[model samples]
Target: MKHLRFLNKYFYKYKWWIIPGVFFVIISNIFGVIPAQVIGHAFNLITENIQIYGLFSGFERREIIYDIFSYSLLYFGALVLVLYLLRGLFLFFMRQTIILMSRHIEYDMKNEIYAHYQELSLGFYRRNNTGDLMNRATEDVNRVRMYVGPAIMYAINTGVLFLLVIYAMFSVNTTLAIFCLLPLPVLVVIIYFVNTMINQKSEQIQEQLSKLSSFVQERFSGIRVIKSYVREPYTKKVFAEESEGYKQSAMSLVKVQALFYPTMLLLVGLSTILTIYVGGKQVINGSITPGNIAEFIVYVNQLTFPVSMLGWVTTLIQRASASQKRINEFLQLKPEIISGKQEKRAINGNIKFENVSFTYPDTGIKALRNVNFEIKQGQFVAIIGRTGSGKSTLANLIMRMYDVEAGRIIIDNTYLKELNLQDYRNQIGFVPQEVFLFSDTIKNNIAFGLDTVNDNEVEAAAKNAAVYNNIIDFELKFETMLGERGITLSGGQKQRVSIARALIKEPKILIFDDCLSAVDTRTEEEILNNLGRIMNNKTSILIAHRISTIKNADKILVLDDGQIIEEGTHNELLQKGGAYAEMYQNQLLEEESQSV
Candidate 1:
């Protein structure tokens, strides 16, 4: 019922097209059955007139036959031509309306799903697999469209054909109709069992396909690691296992379909044979005219078509139902994150974390616990911590990526949740450790977040990030197209491009989350110098492991185990000789060793 309601919205939106298309199905089937009656009547007229002319004495039989039947033959031919032409036109309208409506609905559905994905929080994506989502968006959508267009159209056509043919059959002789339809109960029993099997097999096939797709996508995304570790054979083996699973599921579905179609065709043949035997006896006993027997045979042939098509239509319905269920699961999901009613257009970036603590979903361990910090507007604050010390987690909380499990983070005296999500995020520029670049021109990537791009502003941002010279060295300069995830560029270059992306936003708050770790020391120093100038009136938070990057900051925070053990100027932290001093000394020794 839920699935039906979800699909019904689309049907109702395009009801104009669907209703007329269905009406034409009825018209075409009515016209279709008329031909059967016309042919039977013509055959009877020819045979009966021959017997009547045999009693003529003054005229030759041949002359009487030609004179009596030539007009009727011409009339029969003309009537057939007109009827068939109208039927063909109706079929064209049905296809144009219903098939096109299905296509439109598919387009609308894909867009809606994509929009919904954007609305979903990061936690939703974390819980779902990319390839599985892709399968639901694409393959499942196509299957539903097939149900709407070809499956529904054919089902209706078959139904109308059966109804009109059965009426025509009963009109000629009720006893013959009863005998012809005797195989229906046996066919219904077989179809009921067959449909159940098909439904189960279809669901298995779809699940196996999603798993195979996810396996391939994950393997491809980590191809670099696989090759580095020489795990090609192992990866291939796993892929083969998944592929075999998909193949087995598909064969199960095929097996059900194979049994169902043949069984239906056999039953249709039985019904036709019975109709012929029963109608022949009625003609011999003079209970019905020969013309009526001829018409009954035509109706039997018409009925056979729908019965045989029943299995295929059932298969389509089962597949569509399964697809609808999957898509509805996505559609029904409400995002865990919701925006606040407050609309703050300008944020001063006075951030204060008051006893904030957070734990990731499905994990009992806390990533951050009772962390406290405060940064005044336009202050240069740097956070230094070891791996897994919650440095990144703190940054994530500042950006409202996830709400803290306990306590609250405040910005400019307002709680983080109290500000509008979009308006709040727009005021900050964030560059993370893992830089992602799209497969587009460099200029486009830098200006991606903006509605319009000014070439000069992009170049200036690139210069500020100390990568302007690198851009000009390329043949295409700013127009150079990047490969997937900027694979064509070096790590340092990708990081610089990401920096430029954040810089162009010209945000009130700038965050660098170990973004310069890949760049050479000389380039990193130059970028920091330019960033220092840019951070004059904007609150800047630098999260890094290297002490040299944040040594000159106005204030430094040393975090260990989600607690801030020390907070002071860089020189003050060194004077205290705590975790911050040890990290700085270790990095200095490692650099000296590398130089030697």
Candidate 2:
């Protein structure tokens, strides 16, 4: 129930419409109750031969019939008209308010969740599944809407209707009314047990459904690889198994629902029998009149109708409860990294790693161990290492993707954790190993970071990344649509476009995490040369596997097993005959052999 507290503000916000809706609901129900009373009164007047002596002493019997019939017709017409109008008004405002509230809540929830994702350390995403996150954002929010809108309104209506019917029954005969309500406690017990089961089963069904969706999404995204490897049949089998699990869970819920309605109907049928039998005996004994018995029957039926709807309403609430729990779990997750408490000043690109050590959350292995390094305001440094040698981990640390367990990272003489996260990240530009671009224009991609960059700046960045010529050759030039994840472009072209995106930011520190690995050596050299010409007096860190990529850097560090084994300029490392020299010689040998 606490999980549903997020909806309180929205419900209160729309109280203007809800208050009027409640008023109309009450008016409609009041009119609805009139028909039963009117019919009962008319039946008694005709059966007992009651005369209108006070109103018209001279009127004949035919005139009396005409007058009673006319009044009855008028009352019926007025009752119908009022009920119809009130119902229309209630529904109109209810729908408008519910839809608007759902939209606002969905929008706020998505934005808050997305913002939290951005603030979380990289380790959180690594541990969670992409499909699960999608489920939380889309399916879970919809469940909240169900509870807030239709479920709430129906519950209110049921309570009001039940109370009004009970009061009407008591006015007719209190003893008979008490006997008719005997099955209510039993019905309540059954509903409570069913609601518990429904909540549990609903959770299982939702979880299985998420797995099915995830399996389909992952298979479609990786279809190219699957086809190349001739594993389509195997993939299909896996998907079928996941789909079967979802089916079984859904069937379990169906079985419970199958029992729910019939059980409610049985209880209602028994209650109706008791009302008819007891009321019939009372009328025979002349303890109550036939007109009173007729009205009591109508009220009893009214009570049963709302009681039956309570079962369906309970089922909806159970489903919503399950979904609320899932959504609450996601919202409750605290990010590993915390943003600054105070405002941050501008950065000056001085980076220092003071004996920092880090271990990824939920894993015991150390990624960086007692590492120390420093870079001044303006220098080009390259970090060269083998796979799993912690080069990318070093880059991630400087960007504050994950905080260090021991020691501090300082930028411009201030600890990284003490600075505002959004402000700190704004000062650094990064091109990741895997490039991701939205399905938008090339010009928009290049100008992504800057809110007010001109076309000239976009062109300059593209030219520096050596991708401007390619864009010009396109049919729509920079305005051309790239398709999903930039699927329309070649691998090298995508990397260059991503590079252009990072370069457009004009940050004080630039980091490239093997972004040029896909391009041919000649094209790579051209982009590197362009970068060197434009990156005047700015700190740059390049992570690359090829020796040629980083040979001209002011300093280079060779890493292995999370430790820096060699640190020097390219010429000095070659002279030392250490690990860096060995790697360089091996690369040279491989190239010579390929040429031969």
Candidate 3:
């Protein structure tokens, strides 16, 4: 309930719908209870003239008495039928208002959560799995919907019906009403305990479901790796184990749930028996008519359905609270990377890393150490490093994916964090080392960032990336749809398509982070030459290991173990004969041996 307080705003927002729904429930219950009293009156009339239907004792006046009795009974049945019809009509209206309001609330809640997810930083994603995130947004939200809809509706209906039935019973005979209701107090105490157990079990079930969903999602996403390793049987056995765990967790809840219906029926049956037995005594004492006994019985049965719904509604409320608590966990999180100065701002391609250092938050790995460099407008710079040498870290900082733990980065003579984050990123074209493409047409994949792009621009970018021939060779060409992460294409083709996506943006700063690793040397040379032609006057930073990829850069920096060991042009590095020269010589030998 504390966690569910977050929904107060939505409840207030849809109050008009709720107000009318409550009215309909009250009116509907009024109709629902009236029929029982009508049935009681008809029973009394029948008792008054039980022998009126006889052909001898009342036979002389049988025709007139029969017509009168038949009409009276018909009128009573018609009244009951009318009452029920009205009850059903208002019930329909009640559902229309309340259930529809719940749907609206569900829509608003999901959108709010999705927007919050978008605002969160990459660290949030790193800490949470997609399946768990999805479960919170989808499954948890749906459970909360049940509380807002059916549980709330039935709760109101039960309260209203209980009051009407109890008042009717008390007016006839208080002693009988009191005696009949004795079991209800005991039922309430049992329900309190059941609700406590339900809340605990519901939380456990939700947690287990999240784990299972995550396991399935991860396994399917990495199915290619699993197949490569030939771990199919092993994965299947693990999946079976996970399924059994889920079953056990589910059965625990189901066991508790199974207690509800029988308990409700037992309490209701006890109330019914007391109503009949106690009312018989009252009739014997001349305190009430036979008709009053019939009325009490009808009223008790009228309470039966609502009484049964008590356990069900309580169960829904418990589950909803548990789910809302989970949802609140993520909603309460403040985004770590806050955007500063939202007014539109742009960069002029001048970037300086002044003693920049950073550590990955998730692993606490220091990937950079006192990195300092300067790249002016229109300069082509390349960074070369061994694996884990902080080349990508530098790129990430430039992109502002993560802020430096120490030192400050200046972009265009301003602090990187001070500028508008969205505007700053928009001016830079960054192709990460690992390529990703959406399951979409090739043209749409290349033209993703922009609001709209013409076909010529898409084709020209593809040609510049040297993937135009490959795309056109396909049956659907640019219109071809890809599988997830572009699995429909080869590795080299996917990399080239990703390059085309960045190139099409025509950004002021182009950072290609080892994007050409999958293509052959000849194709890489072709792509680089195309870049050289179009990339004039644009700040291009190429991070790669191969010398051929960075040999033509205006300046080259070599990194070793998170620090830059050498910085020079290609000729100056050869003269120094340091790490850069050593790498160039080794790569040349490998190429020569391959040719031989």
**Which candidate ranks first by TM-score, i.e. highest?**
3
Quantify all predictions' global Cα lDDT against the true fold.
0.87, 0.81, 0.92
lDDT of 3 by residue, 1-596 (tens): 88889999999999999999999999999999888889989999998866556644635677778789989999999999999999999999999999999999999999999999998988899999999999999999999999999999999999999998899889889999998899999888989898999999999989988998999999998999999999999999998998888899889888887987788889889988998899999899999988888888888888889988988999899999999999999999998777768577656798898888889999998898998889998899999989999999889888888888999999889888888888888888889999999999999999997889999999999999999999999999999999998999999999999999999999989999998889998999999898887788889999998999899999999999888899989999999999999999999999999899
lDDT string, candidate 2, 1-596, tens digits: 66677667767877775676566556556655655675566556555644453445565765776677678667755765676576667656656665565567678777877776766678877887788878877887777667776777677777777777778778878877887888889988998898889888888988997887777877787787999999999998998889888888889988988998888778878877887889789888887777776677776676666777787778777777788788778677888888876586778788998988888777777888888888887788999989988888899999988889898999888888888988888878899988999989999988887788898999999988989999999999999999878988999999999999989998889999999988898888888888887678888899999999999998898888888888889999999999999999999999999999
Which residue pairs in model 2 clash with each other? none
Better of 2 and 3 by TM-score: 3
lDDT score for candidate 2 against the true structure: 0.81
Winner on lDDT (1 vs 3) = 3
User: After superposing candidate 3, which stretches have Cα over 4 Å from the reference?
Assistant: 51-58
Query: Alpha-carbon error at 237 in model 3, in Å?
Result: 0.8
lDDT of 3: 0.92
**Rank order by TM-score, top first?**
3, 1, 2
Q: Whole-model lDDT for model 1 versus the true structure?
A: 0.87
